[model samples]
Target: MTYTRFAIYDAPSDDALAEFGATWLGWDIRTGCATDQPDVHGLDDITMTPRKYGFHGTLKPPFRLATGTDVGGLQVAVTEMAATCAPTKSGGLALTTLGGFLALIPTGDLSGLERVAGACVRALDPFRAPQSKADLIRRRKAGLSARQETLMLRWGYPYVMEEFRFHLTLSARMPDQDRAQWFQTAQANLPPLNEIYAIDSIALCGERADGRFELIQRYALTG
Candidate 1:
């Protein structure tokens, strides 16, 4: 099956670019891997495991399309979907700990963002391939809540709508002790958090044979 994902990307500013480069260099050294991990939050002891998928904040979860569903149709739907969603206002982002890893999550009320995300996921659901048995088992391994299970069955992903939290991932996962060190390192290296960041576009990404995600379409929020 073809692997694909839909996500919203923070358009990189000059500062963001430089910060990403520096953070990646540090993570590469810490992980002892030649290539930098795709997400730039930070790599700590807990999240040092290598993931085949590259980093991105999921907007619509990944799915393989049904046999006859064309890419052109999906593109049109995604574009239309994006055009109807309004951008987030007032709330800014902060580097915060999620479970075991540090990430940039929106601070304050984010019901608007969640609504947009949910609408996008639902709007595009018709084109998505039904989950395979293996996919369901893999999802079950995460020990989903009842609501998440309902979401999974209805929308092909568990984390959207009320479950959504906007975050740009930094690391795989890290231990509690290493968390402070990593957080400090990341805060020092990342772009300043005080700036107003926009969640104005969703990027369509595809997985390559080697399993890294590459950008395909970047749909702007026009609403």
Candidate 2:
């Protein structure tokens, strides 16, 4: 059995992402939905991927398990970790352009949200398996800065801790010429992000045989 660990999201349920994904990305890229598609672009298409998983920031960053790690033990640890952290009550987010693609980003005070995300990343990092040589090479293709490279070397992912940004993606990258048009369309259709969006829980997601993601468990923050 193969397993990949995700920080779990608290946004809309699996069904929601699937429905929205079909309309937004022209494909149903969520697990358990009537449709499923591969993540052909990987992190290159951050906007669409996170939205398909629903809204939530990454904490431990997803990873495939090492040969010896126990899946059950990892799940137990994740549940315990979630129980100790309190939910964030930052103001709602807004739809905006990030690196030329559409995303929903925090609008109001986000100190609390950042704190929760950082804590989760640090606490659950022990469970992350090291990146493979191919993975490392792929990450390096982004021409990471020194800090990003350092984080990648230490955490098996380039963006975390100091480099974290809370966002839900909406599309693939676009050319500069088309950016304005895309952004306008995205802004028009997206929900108003200015309201307070609560981060009450974290979800555990799993990849299905067809390469789409599915929610396996949800852990609410009790602290």
Candidate 3:
């Protein structure tokens, strides 16, 4: 299949969490199909934003392939990079509201996760096409700091390396008054939250013509 863009993600390997995420989002990115969502009121509207990408934490943001690079070469580079990245563990995950949106975020020590994210951001960057001028303008509208601007220019994304915060989004930005209700729904529907979020593998995802991302491959961290 032809892909317009590619990204690296840390998708859930745990069956329960994976299933819950796929169902909740109404898209099984791993399987490249839509899922039957639960009949909860307003569930579809709230999840519309994150449904395209499925349940995963971003290791590297999406980018178009560079002029000379192809998916095959990209795969080889990812494999080689993964071989040098030892698996890392995090304190765990928690369902929380982040800047008005619901998400699963890591708690406690994040150094290991940070290291893995940093490595992915740097090592595979050669395959990333430079951000378009409009893209840069859109990013700057978020009021970037000097450091963020530098990172954006260098990495084509401002939120990488020191700025990276791993999260699995569960909903669109909702009104503050509606936050508690959605949070409760998410909690009730979710599997038991992880007590130890381990980074054992990373997935290569491709954006289909329909704009939904689908899992292409998962590379284990063996180093």
Candidate 4:
């Protein structure tokens, strides 16, 4: 079985996004239970792609372990890294369409978010297995830009550091009409994020035998 780790954040259980993910994805990573979907047209098919990923924005993209490194060692390193990093506060999140998909995006400066994510990519890199030829060829089919190719070759995933935009995906790409409707419904379903949310914790997640990712542990940003 292949194992991959991801650094992810969350929305409080009572939060709108929390419920949105539960209903849309059929499972809540936090509760680890199946959930009911909202009664909306094309909801099931539209969410099929991200449903497999559950919810939460990607920090460190998934990758297998490198030789000489194991989950035990990776856990220790992640814990230490979280302790040294400080949590960040953003202007809050807005539900909007990003590249034909629906997601929650930060409304203000994201320098702090960038720092934390970049650190995760760098500090835990030794644990990541290099991208294989198959992976590269598959990714290239998406038609990467020159910079994206560079980042992919270096980090195993293209979107990182300077290229990263923090977004918690709500749905996969859809037709314009579907995207518009979902955006409106999502804005209504998601809880109001008028206050500050501290990006203070990082959850360590791993893919299970079933191909679904599960939250293994969460480390607080102590610094």
Candidate 5:
């Protein structure tokens, strides 16, 4: 099971994108419910891990709050952060293979996206609980480099800073052949996100006891 984390996630801005994503992943973040998903051999297995988190790009990789911290205070901080950060414009979107898996990737203006993610990771870190020894050991098992180990110790997660890659995960690991098949299916069936899109909002999400993450709140970026 994935670690329980309080993450900043970029949720879909519209219902069409939301429904398409939920149907593809089989879990709706807005409703906290499972919905009808695509039917295909091994579709469930392919999407198992991502389905638990719903459709989101990790802005701040998950972390629990420090002792004596409260969720209410966290939500207030997120709202304040969004208020000062202007919305970002993604040049467009694409569907492609990312490390043996499928995800939605931004085409250009990535520097803007990077700023948003970095801000969240830095500004909200005061609330984050330190990584436990068990978690640190688990990350090392994934073969982190010296730089990655350094980032892990500093940020409580291995993939951050220069290592961060913004992706809205579509599936777990797949064979080369299976990846191609699903990519074709997704490109043909999912809603087209090719035109310019705005990163107008951010979502605060919390992991549940059952390992699924639930939407706590969504704050619009107003600046």
Candidate 6:
């Protein structure tokens, strides 16, 4: 299958959590197919934004491939990189509102996860095609700071490196009044969240022609 863009993600390894994500989002990225959503009020509308990408935290945002790069090379390079890194232990995950959206955020030390995300951003950057003028303009319209502009120029993305905050997004930007209702809904539907969240592997995902991202492969951090 041809993919227009690709990204790296830390997808859930736990079966129940993974299933809940797929069902709730109404897209099973692993299977590259849509799933039946749970019976919840306004669920489809709420999940529309994140449904296509499935449930995962971004390690590297989507990017077009560079002129000389190919998926085969990306796979090999990512595998090598993963083999050299150790897994990260997120003290635990908590569901909370972020920038008007609901997401699951890590509550523990972030050094290990930061290192992994940063390495992926830098090491695999050679395969990233330069951002187009329109893309840059669109991003800047969000009101970037000076440091973000610098990061954007150097890394093809601004919210990376020191700016990275790992979160598994669960909803689109909600109205102020609707936030509490959805938060309660999410908490009631989600699986147990008290267990330590481990970032032991990363998945390579490809955005299909339809704009939905599908899993390519998952590389384990064996180091």
**Candidate with the greatest lDDT versus the true structure:** 3
- Over the stretch 92-112, how does candidate 6's per-residue lDDT look in tens digits? 899999999999999878999
C-alpha lDDT of all candidate models, in order: 0.64, 0.64, 0.95, 0.78, 0.86, 0.92
Q: Write the per-residue lDDT of candidate 3 for residues 65-86, one digit (tens) a residue.
A: 9999999999999999999999
Error of 1 at 179 (Å): 1.3
List runs of model 5 lying over 4 Å from the truth.
Answer: 1-4
* Clashing pairs in model 4, backbone N/Cα/C closer than 3 A: 16-191
Q: Which pairs of residues collide in model 5?
A: none
| Model 2: per-residue Cα lDDT at residue 145 | 96
| TM-score winner between candidates 3 and 5 | 3
- Name the candidate that leads on TM-score: 3
Per-model TM-score on C-alpha atoms: 0.80, 0.80, 0.98, 0.92, 0.94, 0.98
The worst-scoring run of ten residues by lDDT in candidate 3 lies at 190-199
**Which TM-score value belongs to model 6?**
0.98
**lDDT, candidate 5, 20-118, per-residue tens:** 889899898777789888777777888899998998889998889898888878988999899988888877778889999999888877888888988
Candidate 1 TM-score to native: 0.80
Candidate order by decreasing lDDT:
3, 6, 5, 4, 2, 1
Count steric clashes of candidate 1. Answer: 7
All models, RMSD in angstroms: 4.9, 4.7, 0.7, 2.0, 2.3, 0.9
* Candidates 3 and 5, the one with greater lDDT: 3
